[model samples]
Target chain A: MILLFLSSGLFLGWSLGANDAANIFGTAVATRMVRFKTAAITSGFFVIAGAVLAGGGATRTLGQLGSVNAMAGAFMVALAAALAVLWMTRAGLPVSVSQAIVGGIIGWNLFTGSPTSIDSLVKIVSTWVICPLLSAVFAAGLYVLARAVTQRSRMHLLAEDAMTRAALMAVGAFGAFSLGANNISNVMGVFVSAIPASSVHLFGFLHVSSDQQLFALGGIAIAIGIFTYSYRVMITVGKGLFRLTPVTALVVILSESLVLFLFASESLEAWLISRGLPSIPLVPVSSSQAVIGAVVGIALVKGGRNLDLRLFRRIAGGWVATPIIAASIAFFGLFFLQNVFDLPVHRPVVYELSDAGIERLRERGVDDEGLAELGGVAFKSARGLTGVLREKTSLGMIDRDVVVDCARRERFVVTRKRIDTLDLKLLTVGQIRALRDITGQEFNYWWELESTLTRESDQWAMLPDTRDNHPANKKLRSNLRQLLDAFRTVDTDD
Target chain B: MANLFARTRLLESKIDEYLNHTSEVGLLFREAMKNFLDGRLDEFEERRGKVCDLENHADELRREVERQLYIETLIPESRGDVLGLLEQTDDVINHVKHALMQVSVENPDIPDELGESYLELADYGSRAVQELVMGVRAFFRNTAAVPDHAHKVAFWEKEADKVAERLKRRIFQLNIDLSHKIQLGDFVMHVDSIADQAEDVSERLSISTIKRSI
Candidate 1:
């Protein structure tokens, strides 16, 4: 029974991933700056991490309000909340998930003797009412900020790509992280209410157990959703809305995250509610709305009166229309995903990366975070300290930040073990060769080609023009710790 | 509640998938239109090639819907409505191709802005389709929900109006000969009608989504 609830929670999480993953890179994907796979893998990891870390608060709030008195009730509330939003999404309206769950909770509360806590409910409802308004106001302010900042560093970044690329990379990671923290709760919060702490476990010590299993379920479900349904939404979001410059995407994501985090906080929500103000805390709002609001804010700053009003009207209509319609369909949709037929199998995800491979990452020096994402994956997958480097060693590519993206597809770990290595980090060039003479990566063609092309005798570092160009190498989908561990041993520092 | 909730999530995913698929086709049409309007045969051929499989699958999907027929489409009226929307979805493809093919014959190098204009109309059409898809999903539960998107169809139709005006102005102001002028005028009209139909699809979609959702 516990397992059933957990899996159902996972299903919800997967759907959440599919829907909300779009929030992270919809514009970037739309503009063709990044691929959906890269966004999905990256988003999957950060969202899970965020849910496990920051997702607790939202889970608690949703669990408390939704009248999830039992495992069955939790499932119902979560399912209803998800169905309501998805129904709207399908119908083409973009209703906030937060709104649907809040509504569902209200409906459920009506049945119970909770007697409609008008005081608490009003504050929560008001947030929904006020958030978009606040978002718009904030968007207006952000537009001004964008204009001011653009003026400040206008010429410097026009030529210096290192600083610009670095900034873009940081912004992208930040956006991905924020998406995880805020959105995963939409999937797991209900399940979080029912799960007991005795059931689940994370990396040895990090025992989220059943106490936090719903969040984990939500995170994993979101991950699955990212793996399955999210690509299309990502395409629509990243590629569909408007063509975005990287800086524009950066600005929009930053603004969206800030605004969402501001709203998600319990303390802030309580404060607002106490003061007879509106707050949308503990509910699932549209990441689409927050991002779009921020984006339009950015766009208005760049091209004011010429701001595309037609696009605006159409989008506004979509937001209004998608939900009502989506709900109607989803209300019926509920009958379909469950009763009529069995669900499909979870497919293994394969990531594809375009033109810019690891060499460009090499061109820009690795930072601590970049190294961590890259190296962290390799080490985390390693065996204990007494006997290390015995498992498979593979090349986990670096990012602009130098960290390996931890969101690889189709991986499950069986046990928890800690491994630490000191020799690999301090290896000299001669020592690396002495080591590589026995154990090494099979970039042999890469080595041979680089040796043939370059005149310099001492150049061991090779940037292959077409080596990683086979349409799939843009993003590496290796085990996180394994990739990170392997990266630490690689002699890329030169 | 749990059973109902489960069904809702699945259906929403299914419908959203179809909506996304439709938009992809719309995107292809837009690309092909741009190429055709620019008289870029090579590019037109390239983008046009990508749609054959899409069109085939679209036909297949519709047939599957007809075959299954558990719940009826509220707006499609008859088999013909299904055929009409399908054809209209394909017409978006055909008109763009026809315009491009015509452009190749009359002016191998049509103005870039002409390509730009056609794409703008295509974009509006795509947006309308998306809204209609949303509305149709609404219709899945309730018919009244359709109007939410139906309202936007007018705005998109207004865009079609803008496209018509531009196509007319461009044709009227052109310095081409009478024979070529007539052919160009006919082609531009077809393009305008295409945009109009796309908007019509949105209108119908909103109606359908509303009906289904309710």
Candidate 2:
């Protein structure tokens, strides 16, 4: 049953592999610079390696887009996005998996009344435009440099040909690696929050988290897609759109690899942040778009006479079509999952007002007398609590947000030993040690532990009541509790 | 990948073979010019016939190279340049064939006073053709060396033209019949055009080489 739920995500991964892997090695294979077999093998191995090692960063951005919070909801969203991509590809449109996944996520947020994060949405949508333009600039610059070197050296034609062939293979492998690292999020990011909280030891040595396992599965699906269906796409990209010299082909591949690496590399983002520069949002962008941008860049540098605008227009049409179709599918699919199938697509999260919630509400200067009457009330989900408080009390969205601090229950008992053994993935070591200092303490409410952790970790500050909850903090707290629950020991002394 | 490069090399080999056939025409022209100067009409006819056969052979090879370039897609990036070069070089071959045919048909009575000058023009034309052949070879083998051979072709072509002009002046100054003098002048112009065609091919070879380099 659980395996069936994973099928849609696997399908998305497969289509992504089928379509996007072409962006990595299509020009090489199509131009006969590299054989299809060699391209597929290199791309398959490196893509899996990249997914297993570096696929974590982009998933964080997708999670911030909107956390679906239910396995059934995640499954439906992935299915909708996959179907949209498959349909677009079959129709011979240039579909971007990142765009489809985003649209599907937005659809879910709308269906569940979860407000979309406009800031993250704008950043991601802008990158879809920016990624290709950046690739174009990089490709043009590299092509000029490559041509100048080839001209100045005046290398023998055969020797130059050999060098170009070797360079294409090396750069193609780099492209495939970046493709897997950046795009695995489109395949399995929906399942991150719902990832099973147990670790699977491979060969009883390497500890593979459930998220990594999902990433590996998605990577394999991409590899399979590359092996089976990428050749046709490669042919189109390689020769049908524009004629490419071997050097131009290598430049295109290198430019695409660099762009993908920029978006997905956490270390690069950290370096930028350390320098007090803005960090790049770790969002999955379209590899196909990047490749096309590179091809166009080369065309522009060659004086812009060669671009097939009709073909490009058709591809651009797919970009607009993908998101709208994906959103529609997700919206209808969620409705079916919730109503017809009797599945909890949006799992109802009921919270009983606790002492900590009321105390936090009072600390934020909410009129205590009016909210006191609703002390013991149980509400289904944070939005439900906000809706009632709006009607009965003088609480605005901000005040309601503060009052809903304990809107979710925490099931973990954070004992000294439990905290010490916690396998939390997102929290830093310092935060974990601070969590450990709260020995023998039990947190039955969400706000109690959050307040205690904020006080203990001098590194973290409790958010002001007027502001919204930080997505990173929310995810960390949720992961910390799950880890504690997994290691929770029975208290016999009680 | 090596397969495509190998096929392109084969195409290049066929072009070299065609160039060799054109160079053979230049050799036959030189031999025929020697025989004509020595008053050996029979041997000149034989040499001219040989140039004709080589021209036919070179035409066949040129056709074959073009067909392979288009059909096999060998060296697709440079296929057009290769085909263009073949066409231009084929003109050099045709001039050899036509000049030799005119020599046999017109049977111009060369004045013994300008016999050595005719041979000089033939030698220059032969040298020009050789230089062009070398330039075309460098185009495929080492594109960077093409300009050097092209410059050599231009030098030999100028020398051939200078000799042809002197021969035309010597034929006109002779006390021969007016029709005979016109025939000799026509013969000299026909022979000089061979070197002129070679110089043109050399220029094209240089241009194509530059295109390929970039």
Candidate 3:
């Protein structure tokens, strides 16, 4: 029975992963902000980390699927939800995992007692509207702000590039962490609860329960989903999700996260209700919807509803269908799983340690600073070379303050580390560690020089020598010749 | 957590350092090219001197990246292509330096008819290639920003094409030797491609951009 919960979660998680992971990296991949391999690996690892660590914000809205008492209730919910998401994915639809879960729970509930968590459900639905709308407004505002700053400062594009790259990385990392804290639970919570106690393993440092294992499985399912089927969805989001600037993405994500955090708080929801606020109350709804709404808000501010209506409609449909069909199927399926199969009459589903909550435990030894840093946290790192660079470029630090800070603070402690340059991969790992993490953004630093440096350098080479007879010209030509010869060798690996 | 945090921070710094390094070189290249095409030989010389130190530093970095690119066994793993791109990009910088060096060495100006148009052509070609370079940058960067490539390339190329055509007609009408005409014509192709490559980059960018639509 416990194994069944584990397997079901594993199965469901894969589906959820397939459905949701696309939403995370789709736009980035589409924009070529990062490649599929890079995005997938980055998103995958972060999503799991987020799932196990920070997830469960607004996760309880999903606590309503005891809708049917049938033996097959759970199975039906899983199957239907999975099918809806799969079908949507096939059609290149931008569906919401949050909504799918909601719909499945509701579909089951409508037939069962239909007793839903009004407080949680209301909040979730409200977020559906608020997240996207606020995100758009936020993005629009940020874009305007960015334009104003750049124009006022008259900062060159080099300065701007340095600033934006660092900023994008930070924003992306925060989103990933928040996602783990919030969404991981959605992927893993139910199955963990379904498991009975005897087979579960508990400890001070870890809980190796069937549920926890299932969560990992769910994460894998998501990884697979992203690898195999996520490309189309990624494309849609990149081009179709929003006409984004890096700043716009930052604004939309931050706004959506803020709204989610607000609704996530029980006190805030009650206060909003008491104050008769126009916005919906504390429901953990679709973050994608929030993002979309935010994009729309920005569009209205900048371009207006004249924004492509065709793509918007297609996206919205996926958001609508995911939850409803998922709920209905879950309700009926679980009903059958229990009754028709004559499965053990386990106690009715309670909010037994939601699987999402369990994800918070992990590799341990993480401290306050780490946790804080993992969140939208910042720290200062002092260094020597940054000053060297700043002086050399004379480009303003206003754009790259964070980067400068990072360089200053994170001192590399090489203990007589005369390492092998031959093991370049090993060296790059060191380089990667020196710069930051495994996220692929750092790799692109070299790639960006094609126009900026290469063309400039080439032009320099071709220019008429002011000292017509200067020996430097001879040296430059020979140097170029050697470089060109080296280039032609193709196999020389530079 | 702080330890992992620290690792990423350190790595980020290193990456930024490398990127900034590339960017600096890029800026130098851009300035040098601009000065060269404008016949500012002195300015090109001043800038060209800065490359010795930076290129030495970059050579180390490039070699490391190339080794890694191979060791990781990445697909499209042609080092030649990478080096070719790098070399061609670098060559343009050197070419600008050399082209200016020649002008200063010979102080040779074309006949008045060709001289004006040559300067104009070089100017157009330089700006056109600059835009192409920008296009290439935007393509790789993937920000909301892209160069106003079409207009820049079209305007510059259009102008360069016009001047080159006139220069060709005049060279023949001037009754220059067939060999010299061929040499002048060859020079024109080089200049044209500079503009054309920048324009060509837009075509590449467009294809990549269309991939977004797909």
Candidate 4:
């Protein structure tokens, strides 16, 4: 059953490999600078390494966008996204899997009457525009520097060729790694919420979480796609698109890889924040758009002759059309799966304004006078609660979201059986002791369990979002999420 | 990576050796012409043999370089241009060898007044060939220097043309048999064609240099 639900995500991973691997290795293989076999093997290995190691940051962002809590719904979301990509690709329009997945998640939110986090949605949408622009800037600058070095060095032509070949291989590997790290989220992020919490011990030492295991599976699927299908796309990309010399191809690929890494690297983000600098948001961006932007950047550096306005228009059209198409597909697909197949597409989340929730809201500076009359009212969906909040209270969007989150009701009983099921390998000794201290407590909300754990031990507490504590805060959040996943129980009253 | 650079270095040296063979062929052709004009038949025959051997060796080296380039798939974008340049430069060497061989086969009885002029014409051809070799080498290392060497090749080829024309005019006015005059005139044209072949290679090198620029 788990395999059946994960099939769509695996398929999405395969398609991502088939299409995007070309953007990384196309020109090198096409120009005969690097052999196809070497390129495929190198990219395949690095991609898996990257997915297993650095894929979490972007997946967390996608979770914030809309957590697809039901396995069947997650399946439909991935299927809708894969279908949208296939449809758009057949139409010869540029499609981004990241955009399609976001749209599919939105579709699931609408179908299940869940509220999409507006902040996450805006951040992701803005990256779609900023990614390409950043790629162009990097490409232009790198091109000039590469050209100047080649000219000033006065190296023998054959020696330069050998050097360029080595550089292409190295850069292609980096590009593959970056692509896997950033884009794996689109393939398996929805399943993160759906899959139960577990950890696999490799060789009795290395602990691999359920999410990492899922990403590894997805990574293998991508590697299979590369070996079986990407050759054709790579050849076409080499010959079809802008006629790039091997050196120019190197520049374009390196620029695209840098952009992907910037968005996906948590260490880089931490380092930047530590230096009192703003950090780039970790979001998956389209490799194809990055390639196109790099090519355009080179063209602009060469005086901007023969610029294709029509292609740009098509890309812009795809940005709008792909999401809408995927959203529509997901909406209809979820309806059919629910009504026709008799599947539980969504697990209903009930919201209520109890006394404790109202007090929690009051502590957060939310005026509770307008909400006094609505106490003990149970709303079936997040949207239902949000509607009531807007009508009854003067809280803004952010405050309303906060109210909805705090009022979300769940039964969390810290029983020994549930505690035994927890992946203790993931938590510190202090955190484990804290969990044991509250082993018999019952709570009605996730925040209640969080508060108890925080009060019991400092290890479970989230520090201020300061530069020095960024990593700690991130780890604490991840630990908290795992605990919530373990303890969350269904309400039989529904 | 070390192996890649080693192969590149080996191919680079082979190309240099081939160019050196071309330059040597031109030098030997001039020496053979001078020996023939000075009535040193034995020395001329020795020089002619050496030119033939160098030309054959250069051909073998060129073929090996071309084979390595394809086998290793090195310099893929500029491979065609480099191959064309090497082949055309080989033609210049072949022209020098053929000119020397023709002088040996035809054994034209040159008048005393025309002997000096014939040696001068051979010197001009040798200079043209040397400049063309420099231009080809520059195409490999410094593209900016190719045009300068190409210009020198054209200048020497023009000089060879002048010497050939004057030698021909003097041959026609000689108080000797018309057959001998015509034969000497044919020899002048043959030696002059060597310089013409070098100029042709120089023209190709210039174009290749332009294509190689980023």
Model 1 CA deviation exceeding 4 Å by range? A6-8, A111-114, A156-165, A197-204, A265-284, A299-494, B1-214
TM-score, chain B, each candidate: 0.68, 0.93, 0.57, 0.97
Better of 2 and 4 by TM-score: 4
> What is the Å distance of residue A87 in model 1 from its true position?
2.1
TM-score of model 2's chain A, to 2 decimals? 0.83
TM-score of 2: 0.75
Model 1 C-alpha lDDT per residue in residues A1-494, reported as the tens digit of each score: 76675565565566667766677666665544455677677777777776766664455455445434345444555566666666667765443565555555554443322223444465565655455655666766765765465545432211212233334445556655656666666666555434433333347444443434556556777777878887788667665565555555656766666666775555555566556665455544566677767766665655654366776676566655543443344334333433564321111122211123234334445223222233222222111210121122222222211212212212221111211211223333543343334333232222222232233222233334343331121111111212222222112221
Provide all candidates' interface root-mean-square deviations: 24.0, 4.3, 10.5, 1.3
| DockQ, computed on Cα atoms, for candidate 1 | 0.01
For residues A96-124, could you state the per-residue lDDT of candidate 4 as single tens digits?
88999999999999999888999999999
- Model 2 deviation from native, Cα RMSD in Å: 6.9
Candidate 3 lDDT over B53-156, as tens digits, reads: 56566556556555643453321212334334344444444444444444445444355557656666667767765665555454333323444665676778
**Residue A237 alpha-carbon offset, candidate 4, angstroms:** 1.7
State the C-alpha RMSD over the true interface residues for candidate 3, after superposing those residues. Answer: 10.5
Q: Against the true structure, whose lDDT is highest? A: 4
Q: Which candidate order results from sorting by lDDT in descending order?
A: 4, 2, 1, 3
